[model samples]
Target: MALQHFAGRHDGNRPLVAADTVDDLLPDLVALRRDLHAHPELAFEEKRTAGIVAAALRLLGLEVHEGLAGTGVVGTLRHGDSARTVGLRADMDALPIAEQSRLGHASRYAGVHHGCGHDGHTAMLLGAARQLARTRRFDGTVHFIFQPAEEGRGGARVMVEQGLFERFPCDAVYALHNWPDLPLGHAQTRPGAIMAAADRFDIVLRGHGGHAAQPHRTPDVLLAASQLVVQLNTIVSRRIDPGESAVLSVTRVAGGSSHNVLPAEATLTGTVRSFDAGAQDLIEAALRDAAAGVALAHGVEADVTYHRYYPATVNSEAEAQLALEAAAAAGLQASVAPRPAFTSEDFAFLLRERPGAYLWLGQGGERALHHPCYDFNDDALPHGVRWFCAVAERALPMDASSPTARR
Candidate 1:
């Protein structure tokens, strides 16, 4: 469908775009979202999604730029000669999980799904882009950023590295994710560290392989790996400060293929989440120490590799307040988030470059993010669209002498 069909008529006297304005665009937005849901794309492979986004932006007469970070798209809208610019970002990637939903629009692909609601995020941002383009309610430039590879492929970081801000400079940027925990129409955010830093660790224990029946013939690499896992779990409790919050989970382990033989090697892989750099360092150090200790006790050689994937998502105080205010202005229930999520986001990389806030738009559902059964709540689309529009308007209000104001 042409995006122009979703545009609402602007009344000069209406100070802000009403919820009903977004409501009028809901059907098209929902269809677009479901289309995206059905054709789920992963990481930097969002060609189809990027094409759709670029086409919609072009239909709205926005300057469209694509191919940044391979499959990222940015649609720029400017008005009233204002130099100020604000970026509204939406991730355009799907998870690698199979869709369990039986909905008519469930993913057509076998092992991919929009389990995290990026489809809704992209649709809402597009809906806002359409509304803002039609209404010209804001004075400054608005860049609708459709980023790829947000699902652990580091799309945001890649965009920044490719000079995302340099080509389309934004004074401030904002992003949102749908939260299944909060009731629909509620929004939440805090000033600092809204999401934790994510780090990955992979450990390999190598020793001599021998018959399982021979008790003393081998170093028992699997035994050392098991012991390492136990000690790694204790790092947070015994090493990290009790006052701080962190999580260490052993998500995967691999060893022997048969019960009759002791494997020469065993490996452990997991993630570390924390909000503080000091704590991250301490945990990494303690993890290596524990692995070394366990390997020594079992007469195995331990090899440890730890990598920090994404930094903690910290929000600037002013931008965070503006985000909450935008939520309230959009007629949603806005409040400070009670606690930061342990989940990590690549948008953290964007925030590191520019002043911005990442928000959670409530979509209340039984299934949480990344769940196979989860789908983006169509009911929350209007709420999110309104919030995006309101944030753009609030960030770059029209001046008395502006063309939009005169109209």
Candidate 2:
């Protein structure tokens, strides 16, 4: 059916896409989503998934560009004569997690799973691409970005470094993730800091090794590591401002091999998350200082290595408003997110390069994200597709003189 048939309808002040259009595409999209879920890939190893995405976009006759950032794909659709453009993105990588669900479509890969709903995200964006390509209801251009390695490998960063915006040149970009916490059909976002920055730290304490029962023979590296964990935990509570939010967790500790032997070295590894740059800087510095102090007191040398992975995901004011408007136009309940999530997103890289917003589409389920049993809620697919299509059409509307009326 032509999307123009229901383009005249409006719910309050927001223009609505016809429900039948998305409904017609839902079954095929669901099947595609499940297929992706069963055959999950990780990080840059998304060859199979990328091929599927490219073929689908080609089937729609989009200008497809592949081999970007190793396994990324960009599908360009242009209509009318306007120069305005918008980007809609979806991540295509899965996690190194084993599937625990007994569902028929559970991951066939033993050690990889779509525990984070990227499969759903990809399917939704593909659905939007198909719908938009079919209707050509908007002016200017829409770039469908199928990114890889979002699960800690930094596909977005690589894409940017390799000239993502330089090639596509979107005036604005938008992406959405299926949020299991919020009820289905609801959406939320904020003007800034939708997700926290992720940083990882590894520390090793070196000293003398000796028998466990020996006195004054060893520097007690394990004991120093334990103390260091306590000190690191206090960095957020005491060093960072109480008004701000930050998390410093010591997730791993390793040292001695034998029960009666004191190891010469102990290692500590963990992650830090924060929204503010000031907080991130202060925490890193304070952590280094605390590690040094502990090591000196224990008569050991401290070695520290820290890596900043992903920056905090911040949404632009105008684009954020556009996302909420698009959500409402899609007939979904929308609101400003009460607080930013502590989890980090690589989409932050894209937002840093362009004006855009990252949105959370609620998909209530029994399990939270990253859980072994977690699966993308197929019921939420139509909501995501509608929002994506609405955002594109709203961002690049056709002028009255154009053959197609504004949807």
Candidate 3:
């Protein structure tokens, strides 16, 4: 499982591609992808995974750096003499789900599984790094950013905070996520607001506890909180514009455990999702108002706290069109989507720093991401690698005369 094997049986002159261009690099991509699949790692804890990535980049003659935000790896493949740079990003984290892939090559970590298909993303980018380094058909630099903790901990933001852009500034940056619901070899994307802003709220309504037989003697916090949940639902369904899309799902609620006794306080927790700031603000306001109304109705004190998490994964129009063109050259049925996706991502941080597009690749009947039974489709690996290579070649065409040595 050395990096040598990842390069495959090669003479450097050996074609990583095929004559048709569409069906190229499948074997090598599969090998590397399977290797990563068997050994998955969790967010911000990808030490061995980092080592493997760094070694592969080094062997490909790219300048590699390790230890960013704990376990992020950045690989620089200089193709020509130009200051213009384009960065490609992949998240390197696994979830706390058990692996159901019975392949002799499943996750080694007992509780950690790459149900998110990050393993395939990492391998596809690595394949691009090697193939592009060998071909060098691009100008400027390609920074392969392997980030961690993308599954809720904001690892992309962490890298940005650590001067990822300042240290190796890029003119444009891009990222792609595998879409299980789409067909294979197809790429789907939208120009803006491709994903929603995800935020969570916790409300604890305090009231006097009393025996069940004498409910009127105490402020009934449970009843008040129950009403509040219904009121919160009315925020989106009744108050918010029907044209706009927003979700207020109360994912968790807890209070009393006894059968006959009333609890002193009842809690309500839920998430808010929206594509824009206006809708986000409106939802927050609606939640606060509903909680206040409920507390007043029951004469109970309410303590509400909201935590704003990842911003909406918005795609820059110009850059998104560029990615669409890349998919076009790669022979994908790429198009701008009608509606923005509601899933949030930390890559929104990267887009905030530079011009770039986040895209989706069809997973071809693959299991949904985060499913315990899911595994990345190996066939789609080559398609992803080709798209990566095609993106670099189009963005930064090679400078044959430039220095082509490992720096």
Candidate 4:
């Protein structure tokens, strides 16, 4: 569409490319996003959402497979029913946040919305499938993965645990997330660790309680907790390697009732981010040690717990290049730059199993995913669809590349 929206709202969209055969289907993809946005579904509770996905792929003439990680849907497109294949993935879950955009397309279902733009992502891949199936442009196979529970539920890990790749299998796979900071229609990618291993920690500070004025007698857990929170900032700043990337932010602290009485216990909750498993271990050890040391130094008992969440997403160089080439062919200004993103993606589990790169698609000026006021930009559908199809056609070329050429 020449990304007419990129220029301004007043300017009309200029048709880009020959519509890729799927261009005509772009309207359907746009409509699909809006409908999903208005009627949002929660993680792992995407029964109706998943059905629509299955129906769309089926309509595209793809061999559909169901039942993975509860509601995960896989659609395989076989140009000649050959063995060679590559995969494209889209998450189907929405956040628990309420629709704050309050736009006309605001989520009709309260307490649930496609806050992360999965609606746009899912429909874009479907658009690509329609184009590929209609044109039968590629000689190899393409697998479309629609996953559930991407919002802190580990649905991707659950799907992997349930043998998603073992059962379906692919040489390489790819996925994308919408970014609010970048300009709309712009695509960027690179090699190495793009996202981090996200884990959460909860600490309970316990101590004797007494009158707030009795400073000499009470252990004052609230006072100890306050100090502990400040010290956590040092774990990533001082304990971890200077060269490695990591983050430890204390997001919530809860305890106490009245203003005068000292609370018996205080709770400290936060998240940790690291690029590698070794970094993850070091951070955990440092947290425990620091928490205990600070609490003991303050004459208070400390109860600390750590929960490892999603693993960091590491992109293989060869596969990343393949994605870039496909993106360029898709008619977008494509480039590779290591993205600095700390947000965790459950799809890291998918990349762990196969050669894959999880990409970030810019949503332009949208309020950003997870924002109560945010909305997934429907205009992004065309670029997303083209990127997925390009990845498929290039990676699984009809005329197979030489042994060295095929990574």
Candidate 5:
């Protein structure tokens, strides 16, 4: 079973029937996913989920490492002596949304649910690990990364900061998310930025408060905040290149407590999304300047806090091609994504350190992500597992001519 002897003998490109790949195991996976969905946990609070993941990986005979980034788990499987390794990641966090679905597996915990399909992601990866362990068809090592807190808490970023790759040291990494927008059983991704860089900015306008009838005696913080909001909307359109894509949305505004009196302070909070670093920088700068200018015009002070969170999720050209090939091998309809999504993913941080690709698995559901009625399509579980296994096999094939490192 030495890896060196297994060289030049990989069957990753051989297509496998998605249904047959996990025929007997499908029910177990669906049950596991449903169990996870029923007891969804929030970001960085996945102790129960991590335990399940660890126990499952241990049963599969993989080396399991726990407690990275709080509730993160990494399972390593090696077949041979090849230095080359590949990593497959899945987020294990739920959103703070109430369950609206009446499914039997609906969230048992109030005000918490797996509206993002992470429950499905976790079960699928576990299925892949089980199959990969049983089959042992590939050389090198495969790291099954169960990351927590991907929902704005930056768990992936924290994992990288804590040296995830330094310990596991993958040649390339890959991640996937179920997309309701695409048809079921389809895999879509593209080289370049697949998801936008997400940044949050908060602005507090402070001014003198007075009765509404004497508005002339006080600086209108509400007016200033409103003007800044309007200005932020124009940054992507007028400030940046027309060819580049960017978005700045004012999602929250808080001001006056009473109708007859002007508030002394107004707070504005929103998000910015962009694909390029230049665009991110441009938007951040624009936000600060716009806030300051409006505050000065209104004779008030603007305290601006622009915090850059996640980088754009960019895929290496070679790895993207490999993912597409792997998807095809898994018998899923694979295609290049026509456009990058505005939503941000913490997986962007992993791509920054290693060459990798992020893909969208089609669930073919009408409900959008984060929707109350959203549910992970159990039918897509086998497809995801097959795709992950194929990607690991292809990325770390027995041959020495694996894809070159991109990061």
Candidate 6:
């Protein structure tokens, strides 16, 4: 089947040789994606999803491994005797959202939905794996990493901490996420800081409790907590440099339940996003300082705990260029992102271990990610599969200038 013969809503110019097999595999790919979307699982509880992935890879005759980080799966395929290896990763977990859309493939399990497009991501990589396994066009090996928990649970970090790279070594790695805002068949990435680092803070303000009628007898913690929330917004605008990007949002706040008595303690929690170490440090410090300053002025004690979950996803220059080239070869419009996204990804952990790039594949929808009405656009399946295949072939070529090619 020719690449140009595959007719769909996203059909464009003829793609490269890597996409020749996609025409015959589109039905199976779409079916698999819909099935996965119907049965959504959250975080580390992807037992059924992981099992399906493992079974599919085994059917492809690739060496499969499971049970790393609870439900992570890795599939290895080798062709020629080249030691060069590349890793292609796809997240396999869903989000905690109720199905609001009436599509046939909408989530059957209430409050569990594939709203973030991981279903499509997994299917695209699987399509590429099947094609690459059948054709054996590349000289080196490819590792298909199906990670389980990408929705704030840090499943990629778990895989890395469990010796993922040491077990199956790779010279380079890559991942793609669906972007609903960009037009279909368009891809975008950059060489540095593709996503921001995510950090969360928990603050506690303690004061003496007293009857509401006699407010002057007790320090008011609720007042201090409210002031702290207002102060946190200043960390990004006033404290940090005007040129740098950062965000501090107060997501949750808790206080007393009694109407007659002032609360003795109040709790505040929120997240911090930054692209550089300087901004991250400044944000953390500012949070602690603001909490202490407010609590002290109110004659109360403040306790703050800051946790850094995922670091910034900074792509290497060489891998970013290679990915753009692969996108061009796959007949997709590609460009560099103007600024890093505030959303954070656990794949940053994998990039830290090995050089790689994470690009956004355009799916083109009005609904944003994590929205109840959002669904993975099926028309972009061929584009994602072909891009992954082309990137693998470009990274691990059959015969470059040397016997082994280093990505």
lDDT of candidate 4 at residue 224, scale 0 to 100: 85
Task: List candidate 4 stretches off by more than 4 Å.
Answer: 1-19, 402-405
| lDDT assessment of candidate 3 | 0.83
Question: All candidates: CA RMSD in angstroms?
Answer: 3.5, 5.2, 4.0, 6.0, 5.4, 5.0
What ranking emerges by lDDT with the best candidate at the front? 2, 1, 6, 5, 3, 4
Q: For model 2, how does the per-residue alpha-carbon lDDT over 104-200 read when each residue is reduced to its tens digit?
A: 9999999999999999999999888877876677888999999999999999999999999999999989999999999998999999999999999
Taking all chains together, the TM-score of candidate 1 against the true structure is 0.94
lDDT of each: 0.90, 0.90, 0.83, 0.80, 0.88, 0.89
Please report, as a residue range, the 10-residue window in candidate 1 with the lowest summed lDDT. Answer: 10-19
Name the regions of candidate 1 deviating beyond 4 angstroms.
2-4, 7-20, 400-407
- Model 2 regions more than 4 Å off: 1-20, 400-407
Candidates 2 and 4 compared: the better one by TM-score is 2
Off by over 4 Å in 6: 1-19, 402-407
* Candidate 6 lDDT: 0.89
Q: Name the regions of candidate 3 deviating beyond 4 angstroms.
A: 8-25, 398-407
Tell me the tens digit of each residue's lDDT in model 4 across 142-198.
889899999899888887899877777888889988878778867777787888889
**Where does candidate 1 clash, by residue pair?**
none
Candidate 5 lDDT by residue in tens digits, 1-407: 11122111224424233234476677778878999999999999999999999988776667899999989999998887877799999999999999899999899999999999999999899889877876776778899999999999999998988889989999999999999999998999999999999998889999989999998999999999888888888888899999999989899999999989999999999999899999889888888889989988999999999988988999999999999999999999999999999999999999999999999999997999999999999899989999998888887776656562222
Ten-residue region with minimum lDDT total, candidate 5: 1-10
**lDDT of each residue in 87-107, candidate 3, tens digit only:** 999888889998987887788
Give the distance in Å from residue 392's predicted Cα in candidate 6 to where it truly belongs: 0.7
RMSD of 5: 5.4
After the best TM-score superposition of candidate 4, give how far the Cα of residue 83 lies from its true spot, in angstroms.
Answer: 2.3
